[model samples]
Target: MTGWTTANILSTLFGAALFPFMIAVAWGKMVEVFGAAGGWVAGFWIVGVSWLLNHGLGLHHQAGDVWIDMAMAAFVGLFVQSTLAGGKPGKAVPALISGVLGGLLGGLILSIMA
Candidate 1:
């Protein structure tokens, strides 16, 4: 909270929102695959994918130690994934809202930790 730079703020928002945003995108698929346990499975899949991307795509987002990846609220879209997959333009509101919230809250949490 003392040294909150624009980079930190932006990074937290991006990192935290990344998981939920992805969840929203993949939620429908997860549900389709695991039936009742898709949410949990998706969460794990998210981390695994992030790790792979971090290595494959070089997503190095660990500034010192306060790296943000809050998947708890991923269900916020519940996510944009379904909307995207469903091809419903209007339903994208929830997905967008969730992403915004995810970014804000994630930034706040990271700021506090920092």
Candidate 2:
């Protein structure tokens, strides 16, 4: 079995816990800069740009390492929260769900290919 280091485990836990807050901040910024619809567009744009940079430029070499994916997810989560939840207190739920799911999906795909 693969042994997990304490730092790795701790970082993972911290990242998971902090994810929602990151999404919230991103959502707030997107909403502030652009309207609801624009936020959605920006979210998609972030994903697309990240993909192009990672694949087109051959930047990502590690499997299952999804820092870019997480950034995309954060943008998307913000978009969802701004559009559907309107930055309400409950918006964090959807934001977290979307961001985590999106990041996981991207990481899984990358891992499979790698």
Quick one: best lDDT, which candidate?
1
True lDDT of residue 35, candidate 2: 81
Q: What's the distance in Å from true for residue 52, model 2?
A: 12
Model 1 regions lying over 4 Å from their true place: 1-30, 56-86
TM-score of structure candidate 2:
0.33
Question: Which digits, one per residue and each the tens of the lDDT, describe model 1 over residues 27-79?
Answer: 66788888869978876777678656543454434455654334433544444
Of candidate 1, the 10-residue stretch with the lowest lDDT total is 68-77
Q: How much is 103 displaced in model 2, in angstroms? A: 14
Candidate 2 root-mean-square deviation in Å: 8.6
Question: What lDDT tens digits, residue by residue, belong to model 2 across residues 26-109?
Answer: 645787788897679756764455555444444333335434344444455555666675566564688678868987897799
lDDT of 1: 0.62
Q: Pick the candidate with the highest TM-score.
A: 1
